[model samples]
Target chain A: MKHFAAALAVSAALAVPAFAQDGETKVIGVSIPAATHGWAGGMNYFAQATVERLEKVYPNLDFVLTTASDPAKQVNDIEDMVAARHVNALVVLPFESEPLTGPVQNAKASGAWITVVDRGLSVEGIEDLYVAGDNPGFGRESGEYVASALPEGGKIVVLRGIPTTIDNERVEGFQKAIEGKNIEILGMEHGNWNRDDSFAVMQDFLSKYPQIDAVWASDDDMAVGVLAAIEAAGRKDIRFVLGGAGMKEMVKRVMDKDTMIPADVTYPPAMIATAIELTAVGLVSSAPVSGKFIIGSVLITPENAEGYYFPDSPF
Target chain B: MKSPKIQMSVVGPVLALVVLLVLGASLNPSFLAWDNVTNVLARSAFIGIIAVGMTFVITAGGLDLSVGSMAAFIAGLMILVMNSALPSLGVGIPIVLLGMAVALAAGLVAGCLNGILISRLGIEAFIVTLGSMGIYRSLVTWLADGGTLSLDFGLRTFYQPVYYGGLFGVSWPIIVFALVVIVGEIAMRSTAFGRHCAAIGSNDQVAKYSSVKVARVRLTTYVVLGLLVGVATILYVPRLGSASPATGLLWELEAIAAVIIGGTMLRGGFGRVWGTVIGVLILSLIGNILNLTDLVSPYLNGAIQGAIIVLAVILQRDTRQGQ
Candidate 1:
């Protein structure tokens, strides 16, 4: 099975050139957030890596990648790409939802194929394709793991990410998954998806409560902070830390099956790579990629950890 | 007259802290716990230490938007240097000491660079530091490849003590923060250089006429700011055992906020070291209070924090005017 998977990846990588014969070179514009924080950094990494791979596979395809620190700049960037770059297809992960909607709508109006990654624009149906990781599933998967791990129903706490619609959905799904179970949630607080903030919040959790069976740090960066806090406090009661987003370091721990971090959930920053690849394929071929591509959150355990691990990838 | 300025500088924040403490304790009894209080203080050390340097800069009529990125860059460099040293040096006392030295030196250099650009070259401090912020942030990102620069596992356990260790009952960070505050207070309040800084900040032409060597005084303050940032980074790196380019994000603003909240003027000519310490405590306590009470939705956390800062500044203004 492992060999089959490797073979599949190799063939899929090689298949892009063979699949694209659109007669002329097509320019693809990719816009994503600059490397301001960990996840975006990873997104930027994967976006560049995927572009490199695709460019080699399909020499006739040209790519223009633009990273913006803010929404207004991103709008200006997208406008420039559409007007001057003469982009045949546009792939964007918006800095924010609402502000980018009208700009994206204008980009769409220019007749370029639109593929939006990660964040969805406020106005729906603006893009020809939408690609995102399952945030609610990410929360639910984490909750379900804890539920089964502690079948006797023990007390647990949660450290949420920044309060966004995504954060709300993740928390809602988490609460929904753990409802009526033997688990008692001791407390929940926002870590703002930051390592330092998570460390502080975890410290408070440890001090406030005497015993906590487990902790769900919704993002891996926060989980790193949570683990540090637990170690510093010298508390052995926390059975495992469940952190999502498949950061390389955390996933490596899961691969090694570190008792402190036994598992992780996937909300990959590389989904941008996936969106770009699919968009490129669509632009080259008659592939029907107009629908939403919702990437499922997979529970990364010790058994299948190597497949998810990317030692070279930044995230 | 002395008492009035003290009232303007220190009393308001002290009172604010006392009222906040009472409110926090009433809202949640755990907010006043000894362990939690130390935790908040230890965590605040990063901002508190950097704000000390910022006090000098602001008091010298300068601002550094690059301190946050500078801290991140320094920490990242320290970790990389330490990690590279581990293979040959081993994770012993020497390696740890070497890492600390590298951190301080990096901080000094980064600070000097900022100082020279702003003071000697006559560039606006704001623009220079702003450009340096991008440079430092990007340099770290390039070094980490947009991921994390983690220390060697062998060194992690040995060096964790710097942050978690204590002298007596106080956490190491709290002790360090106190020492920084004490030394900073003396340097800013009782020394000739302190007066020169105030003089330069008050009026450069007047200071020049008074033989203050305005540029030299300004340059030294930036160096002080950078050195303090280095000190903060040394404490910060151990807590997480790694440094990301994202480390110290927006810390410059936080440090400045603490300085202003502590009653330092934005336009310069005043240095309030102890007041800045109080400002750090107030902000730290507010975060603690927020964490303890979960009733405030996390979505409103930023809004609530902003409101409190505005309220504290308003109260300070009213007190200063009355004084």
Candidate 2:
């Protein structure tokens, strides 16, 4: 029974590629981290919307999108895409750089075009197209905004995301941008980019510090927590809060010119859409879509908040 | 000398908690202030309440890894139900009560499902709960469409008092947490149900021969735990007024850690409610102290917490060996 099952599985695996050769259709497998938080949720939304939109535009393109909850699962997902789907192009927003490197390289070895999104693989020159939101620019844009917002130089606390190379890059960019600007950083702690953790951390920050001029929450989700903590404490000293990653609710507050949330920085989750669209374009058309496409992180204030607001996006 | 040593066994967790308090207060002046103390206690309330239920579960040789995801899933359902009913129920106490009912009902059903699967189907508690954990987490993520399910603004504001407000100087979460602990202590100490759980956990064949109805007792423990998780969610939803996939992440681990640190045996047959409260406080205080001062790198926060939890268990172990 076991031998028969193995033979049946082998034959089924062989049957998939044979079936794919019947048409001029190109298959693009898009792998991403699961929607465990706000930003990833938005990424999932945009990826699905883009996939649906592209399917209508290009009749000969097939798409397989898989969301993994962890790095090992993501690696398996990439492997399955290569083994089962026989994808012409593989678009992946890797969960982590190191573990996913070999799996992505294997996909590349299978003669499939690789579009690495957001997180880059450890090995260089593996991905044919790389699209990512600028982490350094995300931090620099936020730092520049802070420096401009507090021209007179005031003390601020920072709520960082989970510890990672990405977080370190953003913090380094922020510190570099704020150098010589006379802005004093009171403290920095990881909020893990979640609301509850930030809420508790912000409350402790409030208790520890008698007076804080402003807060750089670094992400909109953290900003929401920070703002709530301030409201609960009824602290009037905080002039404004600067949160990045333009969440729809935060962008809406900025659009309305809320005093507490004066402005936001953009680390749009829609970058997933860009990678999927470009991969689709490269598969179907003659457009050269191989190279790094870095989406600049822009500041959203009352003036430009309207353009960044996406009521439909979950984030 | 033996009596004193036996007393010291019970004092291990309390002594550790006291040390954390002193360390926190010494590091920051405001650490012992009423506001800061309340914040820490209120934050611990969610885990503290769940840990109380967890004490019973662990005492009965059962574990529910699904509590965290179960809380998240219940919160999501509560928000969805309230939002959809807002047109008819309106933004008032009726809507808030309705949301609470939904939370309790969902938690009860979820808990019952796990209990039946484990007790009736004769499945291992760990495997059953592990499966339910993934199921609940994924269900919430799917229900929210991979986003956050936020209660309507007006309704959220109206429902805020359940978490933020109190009768005099205490917050609702803290009050609810204290009540649950008191009731849990009584149930675990005086009730026949409690002895049945311990007996079953110690040896199920022996318990059955002793006519304890081991399966019924096991089922009740899970049902009770589910109800308390529901209670915790009632206060939790009002605080954030939203539920996402990130809500209550790793909470089961925290609750389990607190239970084990409080001297409840992971292998079962022993439990403590007040000690679990002390354990919960110790865990929260570690995070609070790490945030209140810059004594160590923020990256070392988890390492510090890990060290303390192990040290706490070791302290209890030494006292047990003395016995």
Scored by lDDT, the top model is 2
Which ten contiguous residues of candidate 1 chain B have the minimum total lDDT? Answer: B1-10
Model 2 Cα lDDT, one tens digit per residue, B82-162: 999999989888888888898898888988999999988999999999999999999999898888888888898889888
lDDT of 2 by residue, A121-201 (tens): 889999999999999998898899899988989899999999998899999999999999999999999999998999999
Q: Which lDDT tens digits does candidate 1 get at residues A1-315?
A: 232244335545554664575446678999988877788888888887787778767767777788887899999999999999888999999989999999889988989999998889999899999999898898899889989888999999899877789998998989899999979998888898889889988998888788999999988999999999998888989998889899999999999879888989999898999999999999878878889999999999999999999888878
**Between which residue pairs do clashes occur in model 2?**
none
TM-score (0 to 1) for chain A, all models?
Answer: 0.92, 0.93
User: Which digits, one per residue and each the tens of the lDDT, describe model 1 over residues B1-323?
Assistant: 45455454456777787888898889887777877888889999999999999999999999999999999999899999999988899989999889889988988899999999998999999999999999999888878877888888769888888999988778888898899999989998899998998888888899999998898889899888888888898898888888887789999999999999888888898889988888888888877777777768766777877877777777678545643
The fnat of each candidate, in order, is: 0.61, 0.85
Q: Which portions of model 2 miss their true places by more than 4 Å?
A: A1-23, B1-3
